[model samples]
Target: MSVTNQTTVTEFILLGFPGPSSLKLTLFVTFLAVYLLSFMGNTLIMFLILMDSTLQTPMYIFLGNLSFLEIWYTTATVPKLLATCLLETVTIPVSGCIAQYYFFFSLGATECILLAVMAYDRHVAVNRPLHYSVLMSIEICLRFSAGSWTGGFIAPLLPTILISHLNFCGPQKIDHFFCDSDPIFKLSCSDTFLAEALGYTCSSVVILTSFLVTMSSYGKIVVTIIKLSSREARKKTFSTCASHLTVVTIYYGTIIFAYVRPPAKYNFTIGKVISVFYCVVTPLVNPLIYTLRNKDVMKAFQKFLAQKRFLLTRNMHKF
Candidate 1:
């Protein structure tokens, strides 16, 4: 490729949900509330897993890693989106834009891998209950978690680097709330076929491989459940993985809809709506999904609250 008179753009204006002032204000308030709630919910999950001994098992260790990831995952984009809602002129430097895209997609990749790991964890617990301890020991779980983080962070690096080197000769307005790959690519003057191809390939590898691993693990789990003789036993076993299945379905559905296709085919408007579901809504609902029906988590939470109450009562008696 050749470039002539490269007046490379330095900054990008994010056209985030353009509308009347009333609409902007409404969006601002709505996103701000969602962001706060998502942050708190994920943080609480991490804290609970850390503080409660009952939650220190392999399953909850994976969950704690997920909670920690969700915190950074949402943080990578939501705050900037909130700014875009409120600010009339929201601009991010080119470097900053690339950084945002990297972190957002990196965390997304991490979640995919982590979810697959969690699925494998579930499969081991269900299919090989006797070997669960040996297979999913805390040390092994920690290694898997660390591997997910490392792979996720590394996966996006090449595509991001290539995209960063592209020349954005003009038209610095990105028609999205945040620095997504498609919107940024749309603004580039350089020939983007190779870069886009690479980006999509890397993304597809992360998404599809992990998705297949999760599905395969779950398939084995389903087979194992079906082998059980008692009807109640099958029902009981399926319930253990039901929450994970729900999360995987929602996460993979929205993510595949948003990212699997070529950027050239994207309708940014529809993409934005889908983005809201996975990027914003999914994180908000995850803690609730994991904890609401979980008897162990409920009991642990009650115990924690009871301990706090007992301490307060003891202090009052001392006074």
Candidate 2:
């Protein structure tokens, strides 16, 4: 069908998870709670990282950025998802859909780069402990962080632009809850070869390269740990990398499975499940993973609470 002949689609209907009407309330409550938890948890992580001078390190700095990213990530999709649960049909204007698409992919790509950078940070800290500070200096950390953000913003530009220009005619229904590339691309009336090519190319370069870098970094860290003589020393050394490793596994595992594939091969059922994990569940779990596994974060949070209590008591006495 020619672009000119097809009817222009001004808005899209998102066919979110379909279930019995009875389950609507349960679904809405579940997603709403997840969104709030993700928001508060990530906010707390960022706040603690900023206020606590004790956490002023390269690792914590990257974590603060990740926390900030997770907050926006959930915001990009969950609200609309909640709406779909409550409403019969969830409609989104074309411009709004495009905007959501851009921010979601950009943030996701930024996280990929950040995770790789974090892995490299761990690599340096563990393998070259004596020179870690000198190697991963403040200047270096800022440059890498800035580069990740910049790369993320730029990486999706070509693909998103290509996708935006494509014609979306009738039957403007997106299978997924969000305005992801695959679903949007599937709806286009024009030839989507270029968009798909660009998307797949970008996904491969960003995801595969980042995954390899992370794996390589961890491999080196493992090698370095084995060389240590003391059992306690080795255990302690591995502990530092544990939280990051866990997060990396969860993030990359779901994303790679979801995006790194041909559109024709995409199973809607599996894609929806994987999308929920990466989009909803992962963000909520991130703060828990970091806080519970990390003593420093827990201590900092406790101290913050104690200080607030003390201030409240002191102010009450004055009143």
Candidate 3:
């Protein structure tokens, strides 16, 4: 082994979205719209849930947590992406790079688990309506919300630890939009069997477990709803479950494609597109999925806004 062989690693470069000068302007606009909507929509949803006591149920409690996660989730990448568009080039330090991926990984993982928790919440609410108060009390709500965040933190520490054992050689270019595990692992010069194995195992456990739990919960819910509730009530209950199921499918499908498979070399364009689906698109779509389908949330939002306006006017008159 020569010195060149011995010196196997340095730094990695991230290549964000590619386009012409005019296209950067277009990308800038599109990214701005996504960032704004993701922020405003999620914030509004959480605000409504918090202000309206009627929305203080277990389901909306999880929704509020999901909305809060969206804020940090999008913030992890969107601002950097927007800055890259403006500066036309950007370099994140290695330390900053790892930290960025840390929180990004955590939040993404938490969201994956949170969606399943939300599914369970709906199942319990609809299927076991009688025990809803006893089962999903405030304590259980807090525990599940905290559990999702805890799992998020726990899931990625293994990968990061395994990554620490490897050294980087040359080939510093990361061929994707952001610093994801797939591209990061690809850039390493060392044999990546251990790291890759861990990646696949973790993805399977996190996603497959969540999916199984959601499905099992829903299966019980369906039978329970039909037996106990009126036809109209059953229809109303399934509507919310269906909407949640749709969002879960879309979000997890993209995630499975990107992360669940065995790690290998990836094409730049394909990776970028898949990354956008999980990162940019999911944050933008999740809030809409719930708000558009659920009338209870809509009514709660109206009530919250009306109360706020009333208070503001009252304060103004007092002044």
Candidate 4:
């Protein structure tokens, strides 16, 4: 194979949501709201899981980490997107693009494995309640969380490194809101086939493998739910799993659509629409779906509020 030794590309211009200049402010405000809510909501959940002694179980521990990941994950892309929409120029240096994709992929990859581990936690809890603590012990939880973070960053790193070495001759524009791999790859003047192929292989490792594990865990869980003798018990179990299943399915479906599928001549309009779901909507809903509906978390939140009120009243009396 022949190689081109040429000047390396230094920067890229992002072609954010395609629309009239008139609409930029509108889009900015809307997505800004999303980004803020996603960050604050996830942050609040993380705090609750940490401060509330009632949430020391294996499940809440994982959920807390997931909330933290969601906050960082959305932060990876949303701030840049907001800036691009409102700033004078949407240019990002080559290094910046790499950094963005790195964190984005890291947090994304972490979430994939994290979700699977959470599913496994649910399975152990529901199907083997007596042994739940034994199976998902503190040590085991730490390992699983560490593995997920490790797994998330391992595969995607090399290809982006490969991309970093490539030359970009002309057309320094990235036709997406952020430095998505596909959009950035298009900016490269060099042949990107090998880079894309490597990326696809890496994606399979992080995405397909983790997805299969999660699905298998859930399958056994469903069977156990059916075998449950009491209808009330079955209802409670299904209720616990349903929200998780919804978020997982939506997150995976969008990922498969955006990344697992081959790169195409994307209609930026449609791409931006789908991007909203994964980047914005999922992050916004993650903490809510996982913890907001949870009775234990709600009870803990109420208790915290009561204590805060009591403290305020006592301080006022002393003053």
Best by TM-score: 2
Predictions in order: lDDT? 0.91, 0.91, 0.79, 0.84
Per-residue C-alpha lDDT of model 3 across residues 1-319, encoded as one tens digit per residue: 1235455544556667777778777888998898899899899889888778888888888989998998899888887777666665566655566677778878988988998898888887876779989989989999999999999889978876787666666566766656777777776767778877886688778888887888788888788768854788778767878877887888888877777765654566887778777778888887888888889988887777788899999999999
How high a TM-score does candidate 4 get? 0.94
> Which runs in model 3 stand beyond 4 Å of their true positions?
1-11, 224-231, 308-319
Local lDDT at 255 for model 1: 93
lDDT of 2 by residue, 28-71 (tens): 99989988988999999999999999987889999999999999
* TM-score computed on alpha carbons, candidate 3: 0.89
Off by over 4 Å in 1: 1-6
Worst 10 residues of 3 by lDDT: 1-10
Candidate 1 C-alpha lDDT tens digits along 19-91: 8989989988988888888889889888889999889999999989998998898888888788888888889
On a 0 to 100 scale, what is the lDDT of residue 174 in model 4? Answer: 80
Q: How well does each candidate superpose onto the true structure, as a TM-score? A: 0.97, 0.97, 0.89, 0.94
Which pairs clash in the backbone of model 1?
none
* The 10-residue segment with the lowest total lDDT in model 1: 1-10
| Cα RMSD to the true fold for all candidates | 1.3, 1.1, 2.6, 2.0
Clashing pairs in 4: none
Return model 4's CA RMSD, one decimal. Answer: 2.0
